[model samples]
Target: MLKVIYILLCILGTFLPYSQFLPFVLEHGFDIRLFFEQLFANRISGFFGMDVIISSLVLWVFVFWEGTRLKMQNLWVYIASNLLVGVSLGLPLFLLMRQFQLEQQTDTAIS
Candidate 1:
């Protein structure tokens, strides 16, 4: 569940580019273009990028830790492992995790 939330947050963060056009962001004097340019330049942006990477890595490690805790049988742990892989591979893997969980629950109840 934590992994799912983290992946969802990453997807949510992608929409942040559009947030620059919002009145609140604009009111705060945020410059979208400059931000993107700096990101493209790969320079320090007050540790934002570093923090993102570090947090993502930590979340991924936690997912693995949780998996080991579960004896590799809990479906959620597998879903979480996939979520981490999805994050690493830059794929829409989280959505699949959600679908798998829904399907698994329904299947279990029917059995």
Candidate 2:
């Protein structure tokens, strides 16, 4: 049930943000460096951007360690999703998947 909630939230969150981003992408055409430059152009955005990036980096390291320890497949998929989408979607999505794996393991162990 909690996994379902995470999945739903991931879908909705990704959709809403990306929908708003579509027009911006059409105008800007996928320039990452330029995006970073503009993102840090202001003091406020700079602080927030740096905060998000550092947090994301830390999360990625932890995800890699734990995912490997748990032998969870598609770990790279989560990383790719993080890169392609955003942490808001990827983090919960990874948690959803991790929960699914745990549920399966528990069921199998019980059986």
Candidate 3:
């Protein structure tokens, strides 16, 4: 059930953001300058932009620290997810993997 929720979240995370972003890319063809211009064009947008930047940084730290503590392999996949989609995809994806790892550990211990 938890895994199912995480999977749903991963789908939402990717689809929701890209639903907005894909059209921008199609219209603008990856205009970095214009993107930044619009991103920080106002205080409200700037707030969200700064928040996401900080959130990404924090996610990296958590991924490195907790992921290594759990001995989770392919940690780069989480980072790549973050880079490609944002926290929406990255966080739920990590949690899904973490849950799997935890279940595996419990099974091993029980055995």
Q: Pick the candidate with the highest TM-score.
A: 3
Better of 1 and 3 by lDDT: 3
Whichever of 1 and 3 has more TM-score, that candidate is: 3
lDDT tens per residue, model 1, 1-111: 656765776565445534543654566567767655665565566476566566566655654564455333443543353333334332234334544555677798899
| lDDT by residue (tens digit), candidate 2, 21-65 | 677789898888878888799999899888878867876987798
Ten-residue segment with the worst summed lDDT in candidate 3? 57-66
Which stretches of candidate 3 lie above 4 Å from their native place? none
Candidate 1, residue 22: CA error in Å? 17
**What is the Cα-based TM-score of model 2?**
0.88
For all predicted structures, in order, the TM-scores are 0.34, 0.88, 0.98
TM-score of 1: 0.34
Model 2 lDDT at residue 52: 73
State the C-alpha lDDT per candidate.
0.51, 0.83, 0.96
lDDT of 1 at 31: 76
Tens digit per residue, CA lDDT, model 3, 27-100: 99999999899999999999999999999999999999999999999999999999999999999999999999
Ranking by lDDT: 3, 2, 1
